[model samples]
Target: SAIYLWRFGSIKSRILTVCQHFFFISFRARPLVQTFTSWKAPIIWEEMFDSILYDQGHTDKNSSVALTVFAVGRYLDAYLKTFLTSAEQHFMLGLPVTYYVFTDSPEKVPNITLASRRNINIVQVEKHTRWQDISMMRMRTISETIESEIRHKFHYVFCFDVDQEFKGRFGSEALGDSVALLHAHYYKLPKAQFTYDRNPKSKAFMETGDFYYHAAIFGGLWQNVKHLVDACYLGIIEDKLNNVEALWHDESHLNKYFWIHKPSKLLSPEYCWDQSIWDKRDILITRLVWAPKHYETLRSG
Candidate 1:
């Protein structure tokens, strides 16, 4: 009877232990979360912010925001509509927003019914034959625009790829002196697996890195954003003079920039998600999701 009771108690305890582990696993930040940088910059993530608090501050200041998007060449036709319409619906709601849309096809800019204080300025840009050139040139363009236009016009600025949809509120919580987004594909992977520009000859080469930020989305205070682009543009120009291009073009340069300067804030991968590539359980809210890619088609054009 004693042996039987002891055995039964052991089985019950083991079952309870398993159940407890399962329960905690569902809530704990699995694989560990680096929610703050070594320098004390807050990494924006779900529940780490209060939207109302952020909204109130911006509202009191009567802040206006600028969102710059490039949709040159074929990307203009395929992505501009969904991206604009979705932006009208979810992006920086209740705030004044000016879209600085750079595209080769201004005629194709969708007629979005934006809320009050929302407007678009369609800027024409030359389309590059190679997709990599198209991506790398954005920094130069953004820097120039900031010097001529955005510096005095807007209190905050954000840059985005036209090939994405805003699925949730991309509100004022993202505002900072400088903000960089964690690459959704690489955030969970070890640093060893990061695709930092490894070529010794490239300006973007990095021997070590803190985080791999996505080039598809990054921005901050207008001045800081301009500073970032100016530096990146210079690096790109230098790499060109040296007859080399970074492995991932601008994205590689972006990662290298963040490694050296470190952004004032980091947006978690939840802010820049690709549904097709990721099955991450930690993403509680997907603010923006990558639209379907026809890379071969886009490149072919």
Candidate 2:
């Protein structure tokens, strides 16, 4: 009755009819708008999982472990070349591994059959224009990339910065349900120095020489990765809302959360030893880098 009166009646009715018509038109288009809004990088987690399992020689019944690396934008060409070579050699050799490189320059890097680049899904992340910007984005991208990998059906996921080279074995044995952190002897800091008022909601507590919570350089394992990423992102979102920037970028956020929450496992620095430090010993130095050209004699363990 109202529609009929509006369609054939006075000026006010005609105006109402036009308004109602537009409103209905917009309402009808809402689904299409939502569809477009949800569009993202073409990510098929299940398909990717299947491929990883099949390639690794894992049977249809067996489970597979996957390594996830986040390399996006214009990372150093040298680092990209070395990282690709080292990772491909280690994980792809004998394991049923699916290496996923979440990167922006997918086409630039040679897409290996064993390990391939996944589309970067996180949106509105500003490109790294300055050193400070790169530092900040590294934290955000690492968190988002880990979350993306966690969504995939894999037993384990290892997230690493592209700048590092893998010289040793990075298999399931080393990362059994715990987080592996590369101990950096050069920049070693006491646990007391790590304490901060950054996490206002949580109480600050530190023990005597508890060196475990010192670094956030490389951390992984499927469940632990998922947990850490979630914690880091949650902390970051809160910081963003409060207009607070972490001192160590996203690393600071990860440190804060992991400090309180506790990681499943903490792998020693031997797994991720920076090449510059020559005095430290023990464990295979799998990851090698040319941080200093003069330190070329340092073995790529």
lDDT of 2 by residue, 44-124 (tens): 111111223233333332335555555555552335556666667665345456555655556656544444422222233
Model 2, runs deviating above 4 Å: 1-63, 113-152, 186-189, 193-209, 212-221, 283-301
Error of 1 at 251 (Å): 1.0
lDDT of 1 at 231: 79
Q: For model 1, which pairs clash?
A: none
Error of 2 at 81 (Å): 2.3
On TM-score, the leading prediction is 1
> Model 1, which residues run further than 4 Å from truth?
1-32, 294-301
When summed lDDT is taken over every stretch of 10 residues in candidate 2, the lowest stretch is 35-44
Estimate, for each residue in 189-217, the C-alpha lDDT of model 1 and write its tens digit: 88999999899999899988997889989
Query: How much is 232 displaced in model 1, in angstroms?
Result: 0.8
